[model samples]
Target: MAHAQDASLVARDDIPKTFDDVIPGGQDFTRKEVMIPMRDGTKLFTVIIIPKGAKDAPMILTRTPYNAGERAGNPKAMTIGDAVPLADAAFVEAGYIRVYQDVRGKYGSEGKYIMMYPPRGPLNPTKTDETTDGWDTIDWLVKHIPESNGRVGMIGSSYEGETVAMALLDPHPALKAAVPESPMIDTYMGDDWFHYGAFRQMMLGYVHMQTVQKGAGAVTPTDTYDKYEEYLRAGSVGDYIRSRGLEKLPFVARMMAHPAYDSFWQGQDLARLMAAKPSNVPTLWEQGLFDQEDMWGANHAWLALKAAGHAANNWLVMGPWSHSQVNGKGYNVGPFKWEGDTARFYNRQMVLPFFEQYLRDGQPAKLARVNIYNTGDDRWDAFDDWPTSCAKGCGTALTPLYLSKGASLAFDKPADAQAADTYVSDPAKPVPFLPRPVLDPFFGYGTDFAGYIPWSSWLLHDQRFVDGRSDVLTYETPVLTSAVRVQGTPKVDLRAMTTGTDGDFVVKLIDVFPPSVPSDPAMGGYQMAIAMDILRGRYRESFEHPTAIPANTPQAYAFELPNVNHVFKPGHRIMVQVQSTLFPLYDRNPQTFVPNIFNAKPGDYQPATITVLRSDSQPSAVWLPVVGKSTTP
Candidate 1:
């Protein structure tokens, strides 16, 4: 007891209170856990991995709702490189500090979670938005981390990608560079939630998986071999999701409440938010040509940035990937093959080099304004601008590919006085998006990973599957004698009369492969959909306000399909297949109009006969941006 008073035995005020002080300074890398405080006094859980000899290294930060520590690496990673996620492999090997954090209200972060939280001062009552949180984290890093050179970079994919994107709104001075890949921005426009107001039925399971807990909840198994059966048996979109007991979830309940693109969704849209005050941060945007979940969020945001006059520091890198595939081996997408390992080439040749120039004090980055992996030709094409072969500056025009009698698609307007194609669209026997016995977005992440045709490559599905159906109107141009390179969003113009008050229209721009392929015979006669989209008839006048269509009256419906940069080579055919329903991919339109589709019952769905017309007065054509002299085949 007497020895307890000794100076050595006494607990000194300077003594370390944590194990972080005991970390030896001689390892290849050191991992530390911390709680980063926000302006609102909320402490977010953070994981920092500082390389062994990392002095003056620029930190690469990734903020995620997903767990940070679990994604750092395997439970038994021996080195920093091994510890790094596949997407961050190249950056970490280059001696960059890797930092990950769980967003507020998720995992270890202390706060109430709001799914798809908007910026402060809008609908958001809280002052601590992603922008504020990002600034605080960057400030803390630059001041506390002695090894860092005080420069920071941000990069992430999917929801994490949105964090990087939102940081651009009011970026920290220390944040020098950023990359947002396959970001989920506008949920209502063309992203995870809806495409032109048509609800994406595939996202029902995903919503439950993402929001059922502090972290990601368990994947709600469909409990059946075929998801189609489960959905079909559920009667309505509301019934299907309600059966899964998701009616009580906050975000889902809110989404159900707001079916139209009203103030609720407009306030949440990142694309609109970014454009209102376009950021000047040197940002590199990425989008997958066939992203299943978020096909156009990044594309729309980048275009919005350009349109808002912030084009100088803005750049884009588009690849033939499906939702974050650039982070892995990308030799091909489904049956389509690339020239080389596109993902590796992108990360090493483009991504790392681009960051090296912006994040560090080094040589100026020599990168194209837009780096696009052209799918049809399988080549990396660089341009000073995107949709380069578009209507205005390029001196080119969007040639109309008209729909004619005898089920033909031609570049010239139909000479026929009057022509019409009619089909019966039954909500009950809706056309399937892909071949049935279709499983859950089947995809394997092995080396040389080519995603499944039904899920990852559903955008590239064979059109022949739906051609023979009586509900579809098939139109095809003659075989192309010369290569026709198309490079922009194709506009679909349909003048149609429907027996029902409401309907949905689906358009597919396809390239029918030749009868045989010498290199890969399995690709023989493949009817690949180069670009496609669906527009709900209700949103014809205004996306924000929907109105029912007049039954049995010809109405003009015009909308742009997804972006395309592909070439139809010699001997291939250009085809257009028009159908009313995309099946379980999108909720049934219930040929009978309802106030809200989510509130719709089984009785609302009915059969309707749709007639597509082509004439001088009501000419229906899909305007294609053909890049060559010979517009027609």
Candidate 2:
């Protein structure tokens, strides 16, 4: 069936125009493609863009797994731009020598490519990895490039951002500044591949994009537009990969073999690497407030570096954008639009100044250590350091919002001695994580990349589609008399029981807008999911050694959702949605425990009845970090 588009919801009138008008013509810069040799004798493809008549300028470098030299010989490629249109135009005009390189074993680069590749230890001086490759490339640029200042800086987003981090591990003497935005640090603990212990099923598409298609130059093998159906037919994750006949893809095979947080994943953890030997490089950790994939990585990396007693020169900036939108002209996500050219504002106010201070020593830095954009209030807040830093004391205490009868949420604790809510969860009929008829059918709903599934900006999509469903247990506060602001991490504490030995619990924090807002037809009574997460009941106690739940007995399952900074306006209401399954986005929990969820058989799937307890002693509530007193109307 063809996907139907709702004209009201699918309209793109709010999309901001490109800022490419500011980009200077390519005639101003000279371009050259070079093959830089690494310590292992393997050559990596790089593109250098130099401004004509410019001398002794600070050099800026970016290394990416994606093709950095896609249009190598074309004059149009001379302008050092990014995936975002005209975002790097200012840097080009500033006359910095720009360099872009393809990381080993992708596109034009030569060498084996490993996904989220770990660094070689200090003892392995002869061995080569991402760190050594970066050091070698930097060494070459400072010596060979003409009109070059000795100082250098690095910046990139997503996978490219991770490369910037890798470069910092063993920084070159000339490397002065580095910014890794929305980097992927750990696949097992958090980020990209998995969330807690639950394997992100969308990663299957990513594996296909990076391995099957890129490796063999093959087209996407599937013909169907609806990937959700395709995934369902495969029964289990292992069955899905094996059905593709992709034994040659080592990463995919390794993921299936190691279903838990084992040694295999521990070796790839970048957090450990940073803690062991933190980089002394002055760094800026930037990310979108709503970045789907690597939202937790940059934050965790900064905290780990500080805990390890690394010299404190780190700064952070989080804006109201998605992964790619961080560098784009617009900062709109779904129906929610932020005022002004937020991306350009960031470049002009924060980014450019940062590089100028560190790379060129042009000016004293005035930016704060932690800068975050509050989504609800549409304002930026500055702090000396992260909220978690004990010295800063910027974080606030978590206030519990309890679930009550009559579909209501309140701050007052449960008065009932024994009250509970129950729902039947069927694997055959799972709740859709996103609304039907996604904008792009082939790419799937709430997915970023066409080749692989990354976190999209679907969290901002209206949750009205599932609000009326019987399977979804929703609770909302009465129309708010004042604006309530929430900052930092939100936790869901559940006291519950299940008929089956294994299941899954999904919780969503929503912002319910009043009917007065006319931005879109669906804006009236729009229920936007601000934060959401899922937990596998089997892994409730431990991710490494998951134990089956005691059937028909009450148990506690608590976990923290990703951090959020938002405000609920005076007329809006706060909402909490609890459900068992989030189909397609996450694999279905069989309700029958299997040693390895990836290897479960068709017969392992079963239905279960879930009960959420609400007694005074065992109350289930969502904990929010309240920043200050509510602003009353």
Candidate 3:
């Protein structure tokens, strides 16, 4: 046996620097290319990764649209593709057989790609979905695998996470546990595309990438990868969209038309399906605080499951990593500040022990309800239950920081303020989000700095990167007297009267820090930056049913910003900004009630007055979940 220190130092010199390097204790597990036949006689292709000696071993089932071949095989140094299988490999080596199966219509599978499923209308009924297929695959795997312990656990990320949620709906008898990492809980509220009501540009961009990847048989084409590099270097989403002609994709057209949460999007909600008689199987849910893709899904799912009275058997783990950072495995930024044995805790302590106890008759009682990683003041905390308290002492504060023309922090009345700082967000010159030359991968996949520093201008060279735009309003607080620890959703209560019948509101919470001494050449100064999160808003007053705002009436707008596990330290300040448009981060709000941004002409666009009345009577403020702050700020 190799010593711990020596084992950590071991690496293959022969292999080139690639995604495969991250796989710990890599091995050629027995691979069998077989068909996972669905109940309807529809055969789904699968690749099972079994331990060297597999007889009566518990199985970890994963159903993905991303393909089983790619999961078992090796790929380049991409984000999500890299750490997925490596994280699961730990379980495989620990006497668990891994079953990776493709959904009905994906690479190597014998069906048509159903786009995003759970079906919207007549296109895909309840009978045809990844969930149904996933259930079928698990049923087959538990019975057929000679080395099966009959007890099984499911695991996945993103779309795969959706698969895990699907498995929870009327799951098989053999399925005993699940770990849905960053699951997609709802598509309408903010899972796949529409956030609040406005569309998410990065999500649509991801759809194009997935379409191309799946089209190419789920294999990373060197040409496509090179093209992606070229696109990233272009510095804008428009350039990438133009380069790929993706503006013409059906998804874009459909998204552009549907500005409200209609039935078309509601059908994709997995929470509805799993709401009743929620899965009896204990769940080990994991998510990334920085995972721009589906962190909201996990955050919301955690709440929903708890509300459903899912007691004791479930555990939730959220970290400060992106989509691919599960198991704490990655390059350069695995355990952020921690040294080695990063991936070991999640695998050895949380996941492996979880399955071992429930499936293999090992101790399972030790698993707590919540094992979350707090990033702001980096540390791990184990909670006996999810925090569901919304009382005055709940973990959040509703504080308003008024916006003024000059860059200043204020907690005063808006009427006293001389001018409101405004910036025009031209669709032609939309703020470049991800895949912009400097940080393409970060923006493209929508998985960048959701849980770290607060330097927005540093990432992009523009100082007005978020300021001076009429679309966005800025507010900040004086240096904090105490460490303001906020966990859970942040909401913005806007007091404004709009000219348009229907419109959208976008809110962002930023961690404003004082200028840093120029130790590095890249950036300097009092960087007013966004720490993590780019939460969107669509006038909640009208969701599926879009009701026009009364021509001259004040409206109260309440929408959630991204959930945070942030601590605004004593010296650092907490800031909240409100805006109507966030550009390529989200689709342009159009400011007026138009059918959709896709077909709306310039003539169709209208300028509307957005007023923020800041007074004791009509106070507009930011709501944050501070650990010890009173709800009324």
Candidate 4:
């Protein structure tokens, strides 16, 4: 095998630099591609990159559904084409042998692909799943790979991250450390597939990307520019899938069949699986505060591991990043910028040290139990433990910001006993989740002739686009007298009535930028959404047994938004926007009562009069986790 001596040996100077440039110079590594056979006789294509002249170096293994050797086929220089680079130069500089493998049925690997393969007991040796395959692969690498120190560590993000979590279940003896970044632990709960029983409309594009498209080189299925219109025209989700001739897609079909949280969904829940066979493998859970896909997984997994009394080292690190930014060293999200290169800092200060300590027996890691990047404050905060075990005694308290008359968000409870707000929610004219001229290719099809904006950036976009819309009820607190810090989860307690049998409620907690801040002139009065979530009214009582709301009957609905660490500066005002629909991002509720929304027809979609009650008896409010005393002058 040829060894990489310099960039000239593999990549041409004339070519533009890619994510692979993160690997530092002066390191010579050799790459070899092989197909490793799993216990079930499935051949998983694996790529091994070993630092030359290193004796007994610890191995870092990453199993991914994404093609592993697609771009990095050459031994002289490994380059990842469009896929984001996994580890930084620190791992290569530290002389760790890196191994990347294509999981079962992905890329060159053999066997049928089952998304989020269910965890089954190892009692049956003949049967194989991700856990068994991971165990077998690790066992094979430790024994067959030359110059290996026998210690192994696993790390990946997104789908690959789920693979890392899967390795934790019945791990091999050589597997010493595991870092699962933004893994999807559950689909139906708070992860990518569903939010409070509401199916993610974006899953259409995602499923097509993974299932129908066989290889890394596969182009997006749609040629149109407006994905929203395409979906809208396709009518109901079931109709959309059938119209696209995707009814045979295993995952999509299964997802539609199980509208409620049933045994099928529960079987794929990684958090629950981890509790069943917990491994204390010195795991580090990394998540992004603004991760559009799997933010809920890492938190739930960490909590489950703690509850299971797993003794090995476990820690959590969160940053102001999107699903992809967690790996890159960027400090900005769209128009919002942070203080430093948080991703680089995390890799250098926390991630590298973690692997060194566990995989190489280097200096002991001094990382806190929980290290989080406070977004608004633009600083890192360390806690001995999450939420409850912070420096401050009780961590933070829920400060209720009530929805008051005059469309105001006040700290005090509502004074009026009969105050209420009403709006007409029409599926035909649903509120745009992002500003007009939506450039997202998923909304139009595969082309965004207008500059392409990554979906993750939408989280940080200004909310002013929908603030003036009558369908969106806006409430804002008076310009803050002092900076208010919100450190934990925010909950929305809503009291409302819908004319339709079923409805969807969307709430966004925003930071209203003051005009004085000159970071960006256009940012003046920018309503930056810090946290938000949605709930399908039919599933209010129980996710397992959904019941539709009776017409004109007021009901209480509540759901917790993802945890956040943000500060509303003194000059800025805290705002909350409430709406029934977030087009394209989530499927529009048909409003009419139906046994299965997936099968609902176009006639099922209707406009309904939605009323939000803010009376003294039913005060609708957003509860924020206020931290520390007011920083008022």
Predicted model with the maximum lDDT = 1
lDDT of each: 0.84, 0.78, 0.60, 0.81
**What does candidate 3's lDDT look like per residue over 1-633, in tens digits?**
569767766664646676434445554456678997787788888987665567888988888777688776543323222323668756766777777888877788887665666542354655666757777887888778887888888888888888888778777888888888888888667665656766655454456666654444221212343322443343333334544566576665565556566766666666655655578888878876666556467767766777777765567887656664664462323223433344456776788888888888887548667776665566666766545223244443445455433545455555643243334434444443433332323233343544332212222222345564556666666667767666665666666656655555656667655455355323233333323333222345667776556644667877666656666666666666665654455555455554544444455456666665554456566655556652211
The local distance difference test score of model 2 is: 0.78
> How do the residues 1-633 of candidate 2 rate in per-residue lDDT, one tens digit apiece?
234455555666666786433345536677788999987789999998788787988888889877887522344543444321366667767878878898888888888788767777542334887888889999999998978887889888888888888887788999999988888877777778887777877666666677653343443467555556767777887787778775458887788888787877776677677778787888988877777677667878887887788637788888887775765665577567887878888877887888889888879779888888888888888877666312134455678889988888888899999999988888887887765422222244444444432346667777887887878899999999988888777888988999999989999999999976765666888887888888888878888788999999999999887777788888899999999887777788888999988889999988888999888988999987776786322
**Model 2 superposed RMSD (Cα):** 9.7
True-structure lDDT of candidate 4: 0.81
Error of 2 at 396 (Å): 2.5
Cα RMSD (Å) per model?
A: 5.8, 9.7, 9.2, 6.6
Clash pairs detected, candidate 4: 225-444, 226-443, 226-444, 227-443, 227-444, 228-443
TM-score of every model? 0.93, 0.89, 0.79, 0.91
How many clashes would you count in candidate 2? 0
Q: Which lDDT value does model 1 have at 398? A: 82
Ranking the candidates on TM-score from highest down gives 1, 4, 2, 3
Error of 3 at 482 (Å): 2.8
What ranges in model 1 sit over 4 Å off? 1-27, 221-223, 391-395, 442-454
Model 1, 70-186: lDDT tens digits are: 866643455677787777888889989889999899988999888878888757887888888999999999999998899999988899899998898899999988899999898
